[model samples]
Target: MSLSARLEHHLQASGLPFEILTHRYAATALENALMAHVPGDHLAKSVLIHKEDGPMLAVLPANHQLDLSRLQSMIHHPIGLAPESELEDLFDDCSPGAAPPVGAAYDLDTIVDNSLSGLDKVWFEAGDHRTLIEMKGRDFDKLMQDAEHGSICVH
Candidate 1:
């Protein structure tokens, strides 16, 4: 298991130390959290939503789900989930179906769910599904400080 080269470079350049945790093969973020033995609330799950302006990455806890209506209202635009085929091209450096929450690494707009702010720790896919990148919550916050923050996830 490995991180996408692009994401690895982004994390390295950010100067924030992190660790990679390997887990059993899982199909969903919740499964990943379970197999990885991490708190579901602290697992960062990324969803790619697209609109006329382009794609935006919506990040939330694995225990939560994206509230598409809320996001559409916030952005004031019609939006929908990006297709898997499109994601393969956009996140080319990563494995199919696995997306890192760090959208800046892929040059996409990003919005993080407020529920994930100010936690003790956070974990997300390593772009290879079987591995996770773990880091301090403050460090994760610093990386996403510039991204919009909102209640985009339903508890």
Candidate 2:
């Protein structure tokens, strides 16, 4: 599969300039960075989490680890990682391990790590293992306008 139809629609409808980047297939964010020759810190990784309300997406740098405690405190409730099965059910249009960081495309709330704010550009999986979507970091923030921002991770 290529980029998810919903993601394409969201990006196009948002009118934020973006580019589709093709690279060797990769199963993890770090592998995607290596294959695409981009800095790990510039690659946004999507981690799915569940809260009492519903599912949420945590977008962070590929080189960083999600700090569960920090995220929980910021959200003021317990949250835990969503399993691969849940990911499959939620992102059926995409391959395993390859969901775009733009959670709004899937009607889910997103949380962006403040660490990503310093990045000049951002790259993330485009719903498949062999492609990424690239855009200016400011544009990314625009795409994530509804997302909450906090120090949700540590490198």
Q: Each model's RMSD to truth, in Å?
A: 0.9, 0.9
| lDDT of each residue in 1-155, candidate 1, tens digit only | 47998899999999998999998888888899999999999999889998898888999999998999999999899999999887888888877878899999999899999988999999998897798999999999998888999989787
Model 2, runs deviating above 4 Å: none
45 in model 2: Cα distance from truth in Å? Answer: 0.8
**Against the hidden reference, what TM-scores do the models get?**
0.97, 0.97
Minimal lDDT window, size 10, model 1? 89-98
How big is the positional error of residue 15 in model 2, measured in Å on the Cα after superposition? 0.5
The count of backbone overlaps in candidate 2 is 0
Error (Å) of candidate 1 at residue 137 is: 0.6
Supply candidate 1's per-residue lDDT for 116: 87
Per-residue lDDT of 26 in model 2: 89
Scored by Cα lDDT, where does model 2 land? 0.92
Model 2, span 1-155: residue lDDT tens: 87898899999999999999999888899899999999999999999998889899999999999999999999898899998999989999999889889999999899999878856999989999999999998998888878889999999
